[model samples]
Target: MSEEQREAVLDEALDAAHVDAAFADQLFGVVDALDTSVALRRAVTDPAASEDRRSGLVHALFGPRVGEGVSGFVADAARRRWTTGRTFVEALEREAVRAQLRAADDDGTLEDTEDGLFRFARIVASDRDLRTALSDRVVPLEVRQRLVSDLLAERATPATLALARRAVAARNRTFDQTVEAYVDLAAAQKNRVVATVRVARPMTDEQRQRLRAALSRQAGRDVVVQEVVDPDVVGGVRVELGDEVLEGTVSAKLDEAKRLFD
Candidate 1:
């Protein structure tokens, strides 16, 4: 299916009244089932197979195991055309994460969850030992999950702790990468764009508000600025939003001048 079609399916699924953290966990369970079973994935995603057949297969396998809402959601998704079985599984995973974020939003903890995920990602990135312990497959999954709970249990909201532990699963990505994805999803849930702003010094509240307003105008959407005060930034601010980077730092200008001379 095209990206638009896939997004439509996700929107419809999430519209279910039962779309919450429990439903999200069930969707994740289905994703794990599909990810680990090639035959099951193929059977559900086969283009030649009739939609009824695929839907029936999904209902038969998961209907009893998951909630009625999740079973119906998965069955409906199976009836749709996906580019690949992997893509189908990924769509399910994405829906699961989005559902979790939506629940957090309902509880007014979405911002906390997003900030917690970003902060934890930064922590993991800066600490080699912690990163290794979390990312190393040799370290048991249970151990890694326990470590996540031990570190963030008291400090983070329930949604944040749940997502942080989920990141330890990693699947096809690193732990930090998974956490970053969760942060992005949380931002997207609020219909806002995320801007990672790097600067030499911390910005005052007024400065942050001004920059946020500017970015919101540029992107045509509300912007959430995640500030990173880095000594190397020298002066000015560098904003990273999705694929685009707005660079105005002294170091960036110096590099541009050096390249011109070369």
Candidate 2:
């Protein structure tokens, strides 16, 4: 199935689970099972397989082992059409992250966990060697997990650690991307989208409010602006909302002008 269709399936599954902590752990177990088995991944996600066969495979493997609801959730996922095996797996990881975030939300520590993840991502982004170490496929998964634990042991909440470790364990995404995805999931739980806004200088509260309102209107969803005060920003602010970028910075405009002249 297309990416949109895959997400639609996930949305249904999440909606059914609501705010259950046990469901999240069950979903995480399903993700762990899939991540460890290449043959299993192929069997469930194969485009040529009939939906019945896919659903049967999920039931046969997980029905006796996992909770009934969890098995049903996996079976539902298997019945969906995925464009590729990797896409199916990535969709599963997204659900796992969402599940954990839901648990955090129930505990009232979700905001802290979300901010902690963003801070950790920024830390990883700033260190080239650390980023390489975390994202390197050559590194053993245990080593990477241990590294994450070491770095976050005291600084992060248990939910944050669990989410981060699971992201790395999912093994198909870069550390930065995985953490960012988790952050986005956290934002979604709060009914908002994250818009990275870079400005030459710090904005007043009024400016921040107005910019967020404008972005919310444009995206047709509530937007939470994560402001970055960039010393180099010129002309205006640069807004990054998902894949769409609005580059109103002076440098970008000057570059565009040069291109037009050429």
- Tell me the alpha-carbon RMSD of every candidate: 4.4, 5.2
lDDT of 1 at 66: 94
Q: Where in model 2 is the C-alpha error above 4 Å?
A: 18-22, 46-50, 170-172, 200-207, 234-237, 248-262
What tens digits encode model 2's per-residue C-alpha lDDT throughout 1-262? 4797779778777767764567777777777788778898999998898999999999999898878887887788888887777678778767767878888888888888988887787788778998888877798988998999999989987778887776676455677787888888899887889987777777878777777777788779998777776767544467778887767534543343223212
Local distance difference test scores for all models? 0.83, 0.78
Q: What TM-score does structure 1 among the candidates reach? A: 0.90
Clashing pairs in 1: none
Q: Candidate 2 at 40: error in angstroms?
A: 1.6
**Model 2's lDDT to the true fold?**
0.78
Cα lDDT for residue 260, candidate 1: 22
Could you tell me the lDDT of residue 171 within candidate 2? 57
Residue 91 lDDT, candidate 2, scale 0-100: 80
Each candidate's clash count: 0, 2
